[model samples]
Target chain A: MSERVKVTIDGISVEVEQGTTILNAARLIGGEIVPPAMCYYSKLEGSGGKCRTCLVKVSKGSEKDPRPMPKLVASCRTTVMEGMEVQNITSPEVKEARKGVVELLLINHPLDCPVCDQAGECHLQDLSYEHGSAATRYEFDRRSFERRDIGDKIQLHMTRCILCYRCVYVADQITDRREHGVLGRGDAAEISTYIEKAIENDFSGNVIDVCPVGALTDRTFRFKNRVWFTKPVDAHCNCDKCSGKVTLWYKGEDVIRVTARKDEYGEVESFICNDCRFEKKKTSDWVIEGPRKISKHSVISANHYEQLAPPPVIRKNPALKEANKEQFERVIRY
Target chain B: MESLSNRKKVLEQKPMTFGEKIYLPSIAKGLAITFKHIFKKRETIFYPEQERPVSENWRGLHSLKRDEQGRERCTACGLCALACPAEAITMTAAERKKGEEGLYREEKYAAVYEINMLRCIFCGLCEEACPKEAIYLDGPFLEADYLRKDFIFGKDKLVEEPLKS
Candidate 1:
């Protein structure tokens, strides 16, 4: 086991193993102090420092050399030192820098949340809502690109891509074959397949789950319904290729879309195969589990109720129960 | 019993006077007041023929708006439906195809936007929740219907007519 190091973030001290990044150290203590990451994924290897949303200020460098760093550092990329003191939300400089980073990320990104399928669950949407300014200062025209189909099952909108390369990393690491990659340079960079070749592999569908934005989305669930309108249920099927564990999104009795189960950090618990994602949309395809619990803060939990049990007062009073008969019936229907 | 509020009033039953016992004078007074109102201005108007003025901010029937280019402005993000207190709004979205740019404003639009007048409280929450400035409660009052199914308004009734240009 690696040696443990003590780090203080936002005035709270937590002991994490050595070589652990500052973000993970803060995540161990887990609360509002944890920095918001846009690109860095704990599952993917060598994926950090692309998006600067997780920048934090180091107040104290180390135990032996107790000198503060000159500038802010990316928390995901910067490893924690012994007795290091970090400031995330407590520092105004980090907040201002995150706002600027959000503006830059939204520069080319279109204001198409009304049409985008990932509007309710998009990480960029959450990032901009918290850190971004009300309006843009950019006077020039925003960049745009025509929609392209990467495959028959997955649709790609290059305009919405933030160039985080998370999807690219998924292709390289998770799948056997790597078909698409970032093309062009600097402002003109885009994720594209060479000669528009289709990305077909056992785990190629994991790219859609890794994408933080609506740049990549399931073609089967395209424009079917909004994310909040559909009910998410935890389900699993027997598959020979990949993990059968998935969340089946139900519009009604029919399973409109199937996706890998995502954790609290919005990362998939286990990547599922392409067959489990696109082909198995019926309710009989998988073993049914009860409704998945979504956070009350998320828009996806708008109408979802955790417990359908009637209030005790309703049982005591018959008049109140009579007035609330429709609601009780609706709860039973759900 | 003692009054908690000290607001209880006591009434006395007194014998009638000679003029009150007769009742002729009081009846005549009531007839005179009734005749006086015959020359006064009528408070009620013929509603179908002469409508009363509504307030500037009055929220009436909802109408889906259209852009100056004759395209439907609604992209159907479902915010209005989510914000609806009465749950009157419902819609299904569809992607706009090629050569249909002139008809719809965005890439995805509401294929079947419906609002049940029977369920709607007309609180204007849907108008407030609309991001595209597409739905507004600006039209005149909704008329009464005989059939219950007719109260469920669809796109044909809610959408405003396109500009002639």
Candidate 2:
């Protein structure tokens, strides 16, 4: 086992592995400092520093060095040093920097949360809720692009993309052959399939699991039902390429959507194949275990199970009836 | 005693003429007035078949409006449901997929929009609160139905016919 390094995040000290990133070190303390790392995936190798929302202020260096870094460093990429002091959750400067990063990501993003299939389980939505400003300072027309089909199963809405490149990394690492990659530059950059070839790889559906936003979504489950209304139950299927442990989003008795089951830290342990994600949607196809413990921020659970108040009964007014009768008697001399 | 003396005396000396006593002239005068109205334009309209012109500002049954591009304008934001004082409106929103741009005006469209006509009071608040101008109260009066369930207007009944390009 490697030697443990002690790190102080927001005055809460914790001991983590020697090569652990500051984001993981802060997570060791749990609730003290939660740096929102949009582009980081624990399962993928070298998976962060793309979205700068995880920037933190380092006050003090390790035992070997006495001076701290001059500027804010990305916690996802920066390693924890011995006795290093980091501030992510508490520092106003770090918060402001994260807000700026989130603002930049949202510049060209379409704010259509109500229609987005990823709204209930979206990482960007949660991060934006925690660290984003309500109003935007940008005054120019938002850049828009025509929606593209990445493969037979995946529909890509380039307008809502934040360009975190998690899908590209997942495809590169997990799949046997890479059929799709990001093309273009800057504001025009997008994930595309080469020569319009359909992504027929077995592990192509795992890209949907890695997407932090609605840029890449499942075409079959698109707009069928909101995620919150459907109860996510832990399910499994018999497949060769994957373990088939997936979450089936059930709307009543019918399974409406399927996704890889994420851990408590919001990371998928094993990437499931396309057959498990798409083909085996039937409730009969997989064994359903139990209901998914929906987080408080989930849009599905927000108002899903609450009992609607019964419609109020309309009552007839006795006084109004008597007044009407008196008026009738006065109108006709009866 | 002085106030009692100032009270007006009840007159009892008047006698009616023969024609007035029998009341034939007064009855004939009433008949003449009734007969005169028959020759003039009729005020009452024939039932069902011949309808009267409704006022321009008449608030009647609700109808979901369509944009000029023959697409549904409602994004299903639930603002109309919130604005409904009678709690008559309910809807489920869905994301508009590709090749469906010709059907929905926005990315978010109502998959199932229903308004309980039995519960609606035709207050026009929903129409006024609509930001997209997708709902209006310009439809004719809701027809009477035998079953209560028939009073519930779904998207099929509320949505306007798509404008032909």
Candidate 3:
């Protein structure tokens, strides 16, 4: 039996397992310190340590010790110790560090949110809004790549990619068959298929969901409707490969898109197969279990069903009227 | 005083001569002028079938335009709606899905575009505000409709047909 370790996150004390990461320990306290994680997913194996947005300062050591760590450690990868003290939520230095990391990640990202399908539901977009700079200091040309079809269903836009590598990890760990991996190096590193082979995996569609940005988008749902406009309904189907609990995005009467239904903590229960994500779009294919409650930040729910106010009546300027009257008097005198 | 005397002089009528008193020559002269028009080209046109030539700058009924590639030029940015003085234009934007590149010029397309013809003063402000060159006021005059609902021009009537390649 593992012993529970007491960890303090932003003054909130949470007792978690001995090997629990500092990120998970903070999450146990509920909203006390939500370190912005782009590359860390709990379900996927070997998922943390990338995307250094979750750095936290350990002010105090475990119960047996009193000394603190010399440097800030990545909370997503660092396991918690008993009586450890972490500063994530109320730290000025951590916030500034996160801002710098987010800025660097956005240096090569293209400004194509208006056309990107993932704009409303993107992790990078949300993180940037919370901790990113509006203006970039990098004045040089941004990297651009030709959009390619990775498989029959997935379209990859490399320009908007932040290289979080979540999709690569998901494909390797979740799916039974892996067809693609990250290729090249440093600034030119990209997710690519072997010898330009089209990804024909059954769970190929999950890569789009794993992508934090618009780098990987569904070809079927591409440019169809924004995520905020479509209402998400929890649904299920009896598929052989996996449990078909998914979210169907309904726009009017038609099912415009489909995605994995995330839990209250915004984590997908399981990676949905390609058939459920792309093939099964009909409303009758799955049983509907009411509408998913949209978050306050959702662009669709905010803009959807909004009755536009009629344009305000434009009143004629009094100065123009006076000028016209003067001109009329002058004409009469002439 | 001078202006009043001038007004009185202008009101005074000159006496007619013996030939003019009969009014036959004057009446004949008027009749001759009227008769001259009978032999000249007719000014009035036949209704329904014939149409008068409209001026080049005439702002008539609105029609949407198509690009050279036959794709719709409108991205549904709503600039025209903001610029409309009459508030006749209303539209909703939707993303242009995959395989719809041939239909829309951009990723954002107008899903529901309607213009209330009754409210539209044909001021051509919408045309001027259109950044896509998608809308213009060059179509034929709006035909009379029996119902009020028919006056509301939807995308079905406004969007131009794709130019055949």
Candidate 4:
């Protein structure tokens, strides 16, 4: 086993592996203190440092050094040291910096959340709501691009790409062949397949999963229904190409779309093949598990009454119970 | 026996006088009240010919709005459908074709938007939930229909009329 190092983030201390990044260390101690990352993916190798949303204040360098870093560092790239201290949400500076970062990210990003397929579960939407300013200060016409199809299945909207390169990383590491990559530089940089080549592979569909924005989306499920309107159920099938485990998004009795199961951070649990994603569109294709547990805060769980138990905190505390009396009454009505 | 709820009144019967037994005085008093109301201001209107003015906040039948360009303003984001507590709103979204830019304000448009007036409580939740400001309860109240299917307002009934060229 690697050596262990103790690090403090947002006043909470956690012991993680020696070479672990501050973001991972904070994640080990999980909760609100963990910094928000746009480009970083745990599954994809070398997928951090591009997006500055995870910037954190390093108050203390290490036990031996005892010196604070001059500037805030990207928590996803900076390694933790023994007795190091970091501030994420606790620091007002970090909060202001994050707001600025969100603004910069939104400069070119077409605010088309209403029409975008990734509206509800989109990370950018959540980040902007939490950290972004209400209106833009930019006085220029925002860049626009004609929507293009990556293939018959995937639709690409260049206007919405934040250039996080998470999809490019997915194309590099997961797929057998890398056909699509970031082209151009600075304001002109965009993800594109060379010479309008089609990315046909077993795992090209995974790019849709990794994309933080609605830049890449499944054309089959295009404009079918909102993410919150569809019900997600965990299902699995016997397939030789890849893991058959997937989440089937049901619009009623029919399976409108199929996607790999996503974790709390919106990362796919496992990359499924194109066959499992595109071919299987019926209920009979896989063994059905129960309804996927959606977070209470998410709009997807708006009307779901399956889990009616009051939160443990409310159950334990009298004050909390008194405050949430109406919610408890609602639960009773159900 | 004592009453469970106390303060009961006892019977007090008395022999009636000639004036009380005749009942002419009581009849005259009732007629006076009826005669007084005849000259008073009218309370109701002839609704079919002269309709009452609806309040500014009155929520009636919903109408899908159009942009200044007269293009359909609804991108079919489904926020209205999600917000409809009665689940009255339903829509099928379609991508705008190459030549259809003049018809739709956005690339994605609601191809088939419907609201079951029977199911709709007309709470104006859909109006409040519309992100594009495409939906509003501004049209006249839904008229009575013979069949249940007619109550389901489709795009034809819901969408606003195109502006004159």
Candidate 5:
């Protein structure tokens, strides 16, 4: 239990525990408002305010005498002060600024939404709907970069990078096994490997989640299906022993995708190792296409499969038939 | 004879016709040529959105090589920097110590290798110059920025994982 703080966001009054961020408190009194958090990992300690996506407006500041708090702040980093009022970052100017930032990111972006696996569920796409311009202003040619195979497990599209240090920051801060880091500066600065090494962490797949866009995607799920068609059903992960809640993406009878479900425990509290999160590969019942057949033995074509049966059991003499063996043995023994 | 040739040009040039004087037909021909080029297969690869295909010998974004055991193969012999014509490459070599056997496959390695992106013309000189095929320029050519400092690509960007068979 902690001290309670009362705050109003868009005329909705709510009381929340102290030390909770504006993002957490807003969740208490549900609203349609959404905060943008870049370079802020809920799991990484002291990892907020890097990209400043979670900006909010505080109308009344102090407990005694309240004035409007700073119109802008990194909500993921800022804690709830007593009697403070938050706007939930819905200002028109804020929208324009965020749009500008996203535009800058898209300037060099390959915009391969059709081919990318994370198109629909991507945070970058979500933000664009709420905070982006209609058209881009970059008249010049964009920066083109080929696919970089940083690790065997992960493929990095350098052109898709927004210069957010979340991947490397989380890698160094939380993973303790840093296989990635930012290289170069400004537009040239990108997420890459240390001397072309494979990212061999047990939890490397989380990079796919931390990435706001499809810059990082599971090599296993490449070009499988569009993300929009699947349904995210909340479930528990059965990887090892960790009971991290996971969302199973359902398309028809199949589970196409699996991801770490966000929870009340926060990103840090929910400790899911790399091996546990590999459940993303867990697929469900498939809807068979074309002619389906059941065969008992070997198949014919080049696409044939063979099924083998168990060998016959060995037999041994059971008790020498009957009592006739006993009588014969008695004579020999005597 | 040169004076007679120069004077002979004026004799044939008599009067300008209506279509020739208007210059409309010639302008239309020029416009058609421009339109043909617009629809034609452009040699320009839109860049950031579309990358140009790399020739087999084309040097691109540098990537340090790895051995079969997943160890770096750079001996850091300063050969690449020496061969660079633009002198864009700079390196600081260090001798391998005892326990770093798994870290670096080779004995000598670059402590620091940087290429000034602004100065580099992608001539592939540095790559051709290297005794060991450590530095390559195959891809991920970055976008142009408003600032000069952003173009300085460091070792972190240059490093890449080994190609899968």
Candidate 6:
């Protein structure tokens, strides 16, 4: 440990390690501090400073002191200086600025949280509750965008995107086959491919994982249910080289979903690949496709024996002729 | 882009009246909306420790499924790979041996079934295309990725776990 530096967050003075972020330091000294980072993660290996929620006021040594760094700095991406002061609770200017930022984000963000899959787990919901203003000044028709299916398992909803470029950055870092990038500028700026090309890499699904909100989600799970209904199971992703623990989700007894569980932030890269997230679906009718459409008087017998059978295995020796699914048409159900 | 000077003016701002300066009417209206939300149900969901429920129609991150005997249901039929508009799935089908018949339900099984989840569109087309009833549309709302490679869901990563006796 290097020299511990003294810093003051509000009036509580404490000594934290050198190069610690304000967010981490604040967490260490507990209070009602409300600074947030929609895109900042301390253990995160990458720096996607796209989300601007982490801004904070840094007054100099004294309350009357004038010479200080920029009035606001991103608490997550910025490191703590020796005697620096962070103001998240008492500063009116900073609070007003942050509230404006949240308002702008809500301008384009679909207010579909009522029915969205991310309703219960969304950062927007939490941030608004913490710092967003009670009113929105935007009354004109908000911009709308078509869905961008970047990969087979990932669907992109430009409407929900706050344009935090974590997906584009992480995708480039992994594939070296740079297929996705943010385009345009300011409010119009967005995460998109060079030519709106489809994402074509083994790690395409990670973009969906990194997205802070429901801007990108699995198409299979589109509008299926609210996120809270599914209980997470502490299981593992059984991929070829990695079979790391997965935060498997269960709705009732059925393993309805899976995602990488972060036991240690960035210590173990989420040990799952696109193949594991998708290939499993190739063999079983495990996910109950909503309820079957039956008349009230319909007679049916419950097959308890089939339900009692063992849970399905996720891996198989890759074999069989590749199905030419191109000829298949999308069956639209009424 | 043309500047406003070059464009025709549509609307102009007028000086505020005494009522506007006081803003009592507007303040009352704003308070009404705020009061509604204050009295309405809370919406935020704390994550990692707590998450909301995933509805039947929610499209989320993907995962592979297994059969009653613990055999991977994926036949490596490659329908998912083929059905994928994003061209995300890949596979190498293998013939099952006589002695290892129990290992696979079908004589022809997928020796390799991998989905470039990074490339998957999650259109649920793979679920639509599979004749084996192996695949389905269901999973997590959020996919957390540390490395770009971790987003790639492979066989070892996607396979289901063994049942606890």
TM-score of chain B of each: 0.90, 0.77, 0.77, 0.83, 0.68, 0.72
Listed per model in order, the count of residue pairs whose N, CA or C atoms clash below 3 Å is 0, 1, 2, 0, 15, 85
Model 5: per-residue lDDT, tens digit, A1-334? 6888887666677788888888767777654664666566666666677666666766677578686654566667678787787776556666566777677667787655534566655666666666777788889888877777756656787777776776787678555666789888876787887888877766666777677777887665554444444455555544564555555566566665656654322233354555545544444322212121212221111122222221222112344324345554444443
Q: Of 2 and 4, which scores higher on TM-score?
A: 4
Q: How many Å off is the CA of A242 in candidate 1?
A: 1.4
Models 1 onward score TM values of 0.94, 0.73, 0.68, 0.91, 0.51, 0.52
DockQ ranking from best candidate downward: 1, 4, 2, 3, 6, 5
Whole-model alpha-carbon lDDT for candidate 6: 0.64
Over the stretch A1-334, how does candidate 1's per-residue lDDT look in tens digits? 7999999999999999999999999889998898988789988999889999999999999999899999999999999999999999999999999999999999999989999999999999999999999899988887788899988988999999999999888888965666778999999999987788788787888889989999999999999999999999998888999879999999988899999999877889988999999999888899987678788889999976655577799877999899988888766655
Q: Candidate 2 on B2-105: residue-level lDDT in tens?
A: 56777777688778989889999999999999999989997888767887789999999888999888889888866577667788988887877889999998
Local distance difference test, each candidate = 0.92, 0.82, 0.81, 0.91, 0.63, 0.64
Say which candidate scores most in DockQ: 1
Model 6, span A162-263: residue lDDT tens: 877777667767766777887788868777877767777766776766677888887666544334444544544345644544555555665555565542
Q: Name every residue pair that clashes in candidate 2.
A: A228-A300
Clashes of 2: 1
CAPRI grade of model 6: incorrect
Worst 10 residues of 5 chain A by lDDT: A293-302
What would you estimate as the lDDT of candidate 4?
A: 0.91
lDDT of 4 by residue, A1-334 (tens): 8999999998998889899999999888888888999899999999999989999999999999979999999999999999999999989999999999999999999888989999998899999999999999988988889889988999999999999999999888865667889999999898999887778788899889999899999999998889998999999999998889999999889899899998877889999999999989999998998678788889888877765577698899999999988888766654
Ranking, lDDT, top scorer first: 1, 4, 2, 3, 6, 5
Best-fitting candidate, measured by TM-score?
1
**What CAPRI-style quality would you assign to candidate 3?**
incorrect
What DockQ does each candidate score versus the true complex, computed on alpha carbons? 0.84, 0.18, 0.12, 0.64, 0.01, 0.01
TM-score pick, better of 5 and 6: 6
Higher-DockQ candidate of 1 and 6: 1
Find the 10 residues in a row with the least total lDDT in model 6 chain A. Answer: A297-306
Query: What local lDDT score does residue A300 receive in model 5, on the 0 to 100 scale?
Result: 11
Off by over 4 Å in 6: A28-34, A43-48, A61-67, A237-243, A262-271, A280-334, B1-165
Of candidates 6 and 2, the better by TM-score: 2
Candidates 1 and 5 compared: the better one by lDDT is 1
- lDDT comparison, 5 vs 6, better candidate: 6
